[model samples]
Target: MSKHFWQTVGLGTIAGFRSMTAPALLTGNLAKFHPQALAGSPLRYLQKPLVATGFKLLAGGELVGDKLPQTPNRIAPPVLLGRLLSGALVGATLYKINHGKTLNGALLGSAVAGLATFGSFWLRKKTTDESGLPSALVGGLEDILVLSSGLALSKGTDIGAPAGRAL
Candidate 1:
């Protein structure tokens, strides 16, 4: 459908790999492109400052905690739910700001995030089993991918755009 719809879906897919990072990226986007959307919300007073700060901290913590031996699987019930919810919220916000169907966006986002979660988990396990590299290194790479993708999707920039046209 619309470019905004695709962008929201892309963000949701990224969120499946890194749940906390997606919301942080969305908060940044809301501050830059849709500040008015937050005006009447409960968080209006805290606004971007608090939202961005809190999510960023959470994202960073997630990345670090992910390397810990006691860390839970991303696909575990609690973690999966968080990722799904984050994807839905970000997708709805993006669609609402772009004047699209919020419910459709949320559904698309949640579905994609769930699929991505399973896909990434399988891929990560396969890679670790085959390559013999430390899981941490592979996970770090995934973190980078998720963060970059989140930023690009949230900014609504064409990833293949010419240098001058890229965000």
Candidate 2:
């Protein structure tokens, strides 16, 4: 489970940079090796229209302005990918926590999410000279906010309790 979470984080981070490549790589890898993991719980929710769209875009190679239509820049793809990856990691972490009767699983989950989001955001900042320092700092801070918020909402106030159970 830990290995899978880390792999997903790495893939999601890569996807964050080139929204099209990461999902295609992830879907293919999951379909090939981690097929069972994709079948249940929060991971199953990925069988949705938005994920399909992302898969299509990724498969179609829209990342490098190759073999795709010219569309204005937007943040939708990366954001959606981030959410999906985060949810999957959180779900898997919760499952392990419940199955093992553990209390620290959610914290681990949040750390993984933070690592992935910050890794991606940092990579983007370091690689792109177009965006100024202010944009990068603000964006990195936003990623941290999102990760913290998601962790709170999914893990709730107590780790031993069920996720969002108190809500």
Counted clashes in each candidate structure: 0, 0
TM-score of each: 0.84, 0.37
Cα lDDT tens digits, model 2, 95-146, are 4423432224333433444455456556545645565655445444544543
What TM-score does model 1 achieve against the real structure?
A: 0.84
- Candidate 2 Cα RMSD after full superposition onto the native fold (Å): 11.8
- Model 2, residue pairs in steric clash: none
lDDT of 1 by residue, 63-111 (tens): 9998887888989999899889878877776665554576886888788
lDDT of 2: 0.42
Question: Deviation in angstroms for 124 in model 1?
Answer: 0.6
Number of the top TM-score candidate: 1
lDDT of 2 at 107: 39
Residue 22 error for model 1, in Å? 0.8
